[model samples]
Target: MRVFGMQHIGFTVPHLEEAVRFFEAAFGAVTCLETGRIEADDAFMQRRLGVPAGCRIENIKVLRIGNGTNLELFQYSGEEDGEEPLKRNSQSGGFHLAFEVDDCHSAADRLRQAGVDVLEGPTFVDAGAMQGLTWLYLRAPWGQFLELVSMNGALGYERAGGPKQWSPVTGE
Candidate 1:
């Protein structure tokens, strides 16, 4: 079978409750499922999650933002070890999750006012129809990378005789 769109994006955090608060306060995300301690070191954990033996995955939470995407956030505390947390987008395997915003500059200001470390804001493009697009990158308190993009009006493809990008609104 062919794959559709994304179902969710999962990541483990140092603090589960704090991450929940951040998602709620920052992106207006609501909790869909709140799981209690899930201590397991058996085959289920090892086979399904690769959570090796002598380890425990206690607190787990799931949050949903706009669109149909879900963020599966987990807090790990156990004997099995993992690498230390790194800065936002610090390595080749690092990536940032982006969200669509109505306005870039204003959102950047709002994030700055919220005490988030603003990496860059309103990095506009100087090209064809993409001139209207604006992007901003910001970092969470826990060092997770996030990006903001505003896609409106006609873009480069549309101007170049190409079809517009698929969106929930236009459904093109």
Candidate 2:
């Protein structure tokens, strides 16, 4: 089976307010949803995912980071049991998540000025079709690796620089 597209990327945070504020300052994302109960909304996810009963799930905020893509943040009550956020090489294997930006340099500057750790970049990625593309990596306040790509390139299920072409196969 072929996968369609990414629905959303989820992150578990200790505090919702702080995470929300950081994202707002860094990416200009606005709060789209704030819910307290995961179980009430989806009992299957709650039960199957091992989300404890009565867990204080707050501020399931969705930010429109790119075209038809969203960044979903979840703030669970109490301390985080997982590895510390922002430690790129920590026990948590997941390295980073990227967002498309109009201008990577400006975005990096904004993030740096806002006290977010600008790890690297605003550098070029020579991906053949698109040269001189700029991108940078930053550590979100919650320690998640956020990549800002500054290039006018199409992504996901669509070809870069032009319309997509589909091919059909014949059954023998």
Candidate 3:
């Protein structure tokens, strides 16, 4: 058997509407699908997703960024307070999502003009395999760290001896 590319990545959010707006405004994400809810139980969730014993989420939503990856936003409550927004991508199980943009600098500038917090950005890499890459890291309204990256042209490794680079971007 073989595993192919990723379909989507899921993220838990405190507010569904807010997240929807963020996705729409930030990445021009389109709403693909939404669901009602699932019963709160250990067996049901555990068997499917191993989601502890309790915690049945409501208002599950899915957003797609152009033709790239999809973001699955699930609105869940009652797990605990303060955990609504995660901080520091340093913990053991922490992770960040990244999206490939056509022009990294322009994208970052647009984001800044939109009043979004662009933490670090427009960093150019010119030494390694990422030679022609430009990237920026920004925080979502809910504090999730996401990145905008691009290598509009061929990288150093690709020019030298690396395999062909694949892009999720649609339309040349």
The TM-scores, one per candidate, come to: 0.85, 0.68, 0.88
- Please tell me which predicted candidate would have the highest lDDT against the true structure: 3
TM-score of model 1 vs. true structure: 0.85
Q: Global CA lDDT of candidate 3, please?
A: 0.82
The C-alpha local distance difference test score for the whole of candidate 1 amounts to 0.78
Give per-model CA RMSD: 2.6, 7.2, 2.2
**lDDT, candidate 1, residue 106?**
91
Worst 10 residues of 3 by lDDT: 76-85
Residue 150's lDDT within candidate 1 is 85
- Whichever of 1 and 3 has more lDDT, that candidate is 3
lDDT of every model, 2 decimals: 0.78, 0.65, 0.82
lDDT of 3 by residue, 45-163 (tens): 77887666666787798898977668899987546746345756888777888888889899998999999889776899979978988989998887888898888678888888898
Error of 2 at 171 (Å): 33
Output the TM-score of candidate 2: 0.68
**Stretches of model 1 off by over 4 angstroms after superposition:** 79-83, 87-90, 128-130, 161-172
From the highest lDDT down, the ranking of the candidates is: 3, 1, 2
